[model samples]
Target: MTAETSEPPAFLPGLELSRILYEEGVRPVLDAAHPGLAYAAARVGSGSEVLGFDTARSADHEWGPRLNLFLADADAAALGPAIRELLAERLPKHVRGWPTHFRSDAGNELDPVSGHMTATDGPVDHRVSVDGIGSWLRRQVGSPTAELGPLDWLAVPQQRLLEATAGAVFHDGPGTLTAARARLARYPDEVWRHLLACQWQRISQEEAFVGRCAEVGDDLGSAVVAARLVRDLMRLCLLIDRGYAPYGKWLGTAFARLPVAGRLTPVLRGALAATTYPDRESRLCEAYETVAALQNATGLTEPVDPSCRPYHSRPFRVLHADRFARALAATVTESALRDRPLTGSVDQWVDNTDHLTSSRLEVPE
Candidate 1:
């Protein structure tokens, strides 16, 4: 009989599809032909599922009934084809109401996935596995001999990195899956420290420049600074937990749940909502101080500036300013608590038009 014989239910929640496949499709193959076929796992890696943001519309092709099969090289070579053929023969051609042969509705002419799979429009966009334990480690963190360089912190898009590293590993044999998961669990302490440091440095460099931005008649530029502050601050919280920050859409959701979340939310919301350039600058500076205090409280870094000095100054002032800003962001738990020390200086917030050109950072069209 053709695999298309039975019509299936509507798309199960992405989380449920794996079990549905295992009990029906994958296990049957092992029961019949390859007793040593070894293992199957439903790792919803990459894209929305990994980030826990998947919705109903994500149930298009490349989205559901996905599985990654792992075996000893010999078993894989033997069982892979058998599993495929069996699935082709016995698995329902449609899961839920979705078609197994669904194609791209994406307007562009991108190539569709080349395997037989049903759709749920979920966030899992790919399925894969390493040959064994060693390969899994290398894939997760790079080999010692051919180590992956530390990411170019500034250039990496937060969402892509989140997807690359997100998701759960469903199964493993001989500890290969466990080992890969341990390695993927979190960034090393130093790496998190460095990224947090770099992000804060970026924010501090722009913090007091809001008034200058508005002086050039670009209130929007000032708002961009506020937005970046929010992004970097959210990144800081993720660093505190040793987690990589996901894309911005989920950034706030993640932030609101942090242990220090209660205090941070108001400060962040106030900073984001401040309409006047001066008010925004004050709130931002206060936010920096609050974070600095939290850093000190947490023992994350050495004390630099208890005062939270203005950003406009010479080498020493700039140096201390960046130092405290970095320390606070990495260690602070409650954002509002850290921002208690609001600044009194307004002069540093003003901008000169000469430095406000729109073309210095422009790229070719």
Candidate 2:
């Protein structure tokens, strides 16, 4: 992003740019310096491009030709530094018209290591990260072993899980990255059901509040409750399809790709846009039934009527979503997870970035 060049190269998607970097810039260096060196190369962690949703504007920072180069534990310790040094001496000044050299994105901030693109004549400080797959996975999901327990799955954030699984793997010479990705691709059956039940439990707790707030003449409170339910419903749809919901910045972008988004989007928007209580209740009820039917179609549990009924002793219409929650919970066969509380995972109850990013997150018993 340095002005040393007239301007940065016209934007190419980040994943594709990373692929070109490996093939043209990094591969030739490896092929010559350490022939037959076994490694796995990929663009699999922490970037908008990894998720295939990055736009032209993403080029501003933390967006360029970058990828993870994974090696065996022993090789990583023995040769990682040498490989990095070799790339620095040999990689082209430019690849596909973007600078191979990089510098810190922060103009005045600390952390001096270069992390963004800029033109340079000196040995280009590059971003070809080197480490073992196990170490990388351990840093990512807290468990180094391939076999992740139920508690392990609960501890890792959904966003991190998405980062580990979404991006393309250009090579797997170590013969383990693909398997590792597949293993982390989705939650186990029992855990998924538990998540579904907990999502429904969330809705059951609040679906009546949209109407009750308006009943008490708190239009603002009613609108706020309606928006919260809309968000929960969207997250539930994501769970139903087995997609990991990204952080709030990209939740709707991810949800828009779901099969149910076509019909569900309008009902959800209607609920969010409603000013009066009647319109909010009507749209919310429509959404409730739509999602309920979608859940029933999965055949995960006994089908509950997807109809809206009055909240007991009040005129507010509700889905009594606990019917879905209890039915799904009944189908859980995993003894460790059965009869557990409705909290699904760390991300379910907590949204703190510091906690979500930590690899040492403790799972509650």
Candidate 3:
């Protein structure tokens, strides 16, 4: 039998579909097949659902009825293939009218099996991935756990780190995978403070250029600098909130959820929408004060003044963000981390997804 529906079906969220597949399909079959197989199941890695941003538009490809079933290395080596084959035969053809098999041809067009839905006969190229946890972690992030040092945390992109920890786990029988996830959830405290300091340093480096560019009669350049500062400020807020900032597509979405977003959004928006340099500078100053207050509230460092001031010797009005940087850096007790330059994490310095996504990313010593 084939898998198809009468008409275009309403959108189903990936997380819900994954849970249903695990409870109704995979769990029963696993119980009957091996009786006591130990495995973990989750819907995670590189999807909007993992990030809680999936929508109807995300249903096209690489979506629907998909999950990761992680087994211990030995269990995976022995029963992986048999379980995969068994699921192809026993699993339901459709979960909430979406196909169990996700078929993509040369042009990447998704074609679900086109006829009747059946339990025993359907396409065999199922979306469920069966693997060992170690292999999965190595595949997802370069390391199996967050035993990462300062440089290791810097090298891995925040997007990758976010993906490594974002989604929901349906079940973890042995709990190894769950434990691994907890370890990978966030950077160590020292690393977080180091990155936070570096982020403020980034703002300090460019905060003066907004007015300097305007002084040179470069309104466009001034606006550009202001926009850059706005992004840095948003990211800094995310860091203060102890949240991972996703890439550009979801950056605003994620930022909106921050505690300070309500007060800061308008100021940031004004900074970006300002055409004149004075207007831009004024709006950015407002943003600076707001974020500085957020920093003070965190009590991460002794509160620095949340007001903008002149960049010394230059006529530019700015926050002199290095003050905040220095305050945060002072709290870092790790000698190695304290001595390192303030480059922050991969996402802070690099905007290109291609470079950030590379597994071989080099961390500066």
Best candidate, lDDT-wise? 2
For model 1, how does the per-residue alpha-carbon lDDT over 191-288 read when each residue is reduced to its tens digit? 44555555556656766556567667788888887877766676666666666665445778777767767877788888789887776766766666
- Can you write out model 3's per-residue Cα lDDT over 1-365, one digit (the tens) per residue? 13333453677778888999899988998998888888999987777888888898776567778888999877788888888999888888778777786554545335553222222355446778899877767666666544566677777788887877888898999988888778878778999899989999999999999998999899999888888898888888888888888888889999999888888899999999998888888999889998889889988887799899888988878999999999999999987788888887778777997776555646565
Give one digit per residue, the lDDT tens place, for model 2 in 233-304: 999999999889887878899999998899999999999998889999999999999999999999998789
TM-score result, candidate 3: 0.91
lDDT of 2 at 256: 95
Ranking by TM-score: 2, 3, 1
For model 1, what is the alpha-carbon lDDT of residue 229? Answer: 72
* Candidate 1 lDDT (Cα, 0 to 1): 0.51
Reference-based lDDT, residue 203, model 3: 94
TM-score of each: 0.67, 0.96, 0.91
Better of 2 and 3 by lDDT: 2
Candidate with the larger TM-score of 1 and 2: 2
